[model samples]
Target: MEPWPFDTITPEEIDALTDEEKQGLDAAVAAYIGECLRRRGVDPAPPTSTPA
Candidate 1:
């Protein structure tokens, strides 16, 4: 991945990720953002899952 500016990454860069990598990144970022929101008194909705 390119160096720095992670928060402003472009879609073309994200498109380089494999399916599994994309899902993993999505989950990680979601968790991090959710935690940050909760820390600031914003209650995030409960996570839901669907069977593959």
Candidate 2:
């Protein structure tokens, strides 16, 4: 995977991204988080049902 695009960004900078760019960034962030969780032996799956 490629390196992350930015080390830090302001809200205005995020707001300036195009829809496609925003989607790409969102996916990248999610993947990065999932990988980190996996490395820590944490399950990343969502619960199958909500708690009562």
Candidate 3:
């Protein structure tokens, strides 16, 4: 995925993003957080569901 398009964004700027842009931003952030977790030896996967 391409890097975030802007260095920084204001709330208004985020609010103005097109739907596709918002999806891209969300993906970029998720990817970045996953990488950080991996670097710290943490599993990035979602926790397994427990039986009720």
Best by TM-score: 2
TM-score to native of every candidate shown: 0.66, 0.69, 0.65
lDDT of 2 at 14: 89
Candidate 3 residue lDDT tens string, 1-52: 7766676776689889988888788778878988999999998986366222
Q: Candidate 2: which stretches are off by over 4 Å?
A: 1-7, 45-52
Decide which is better by TM-score, 2 or 3.
2
Model 2 scores a TM of 0.69
Tell me, what's the RMSD of every candidate? 6.5, 8.9, 9.2
Model 1 alpha-carbon drift over 4 Å, by segment: 1-7, 46-52
lDDT of 1 at 26: 80
Over 1-52, each residue of candidate 1 has an lDDT whose tens digit, in order, gives 7766567788788889888888888889888989899899998887687323
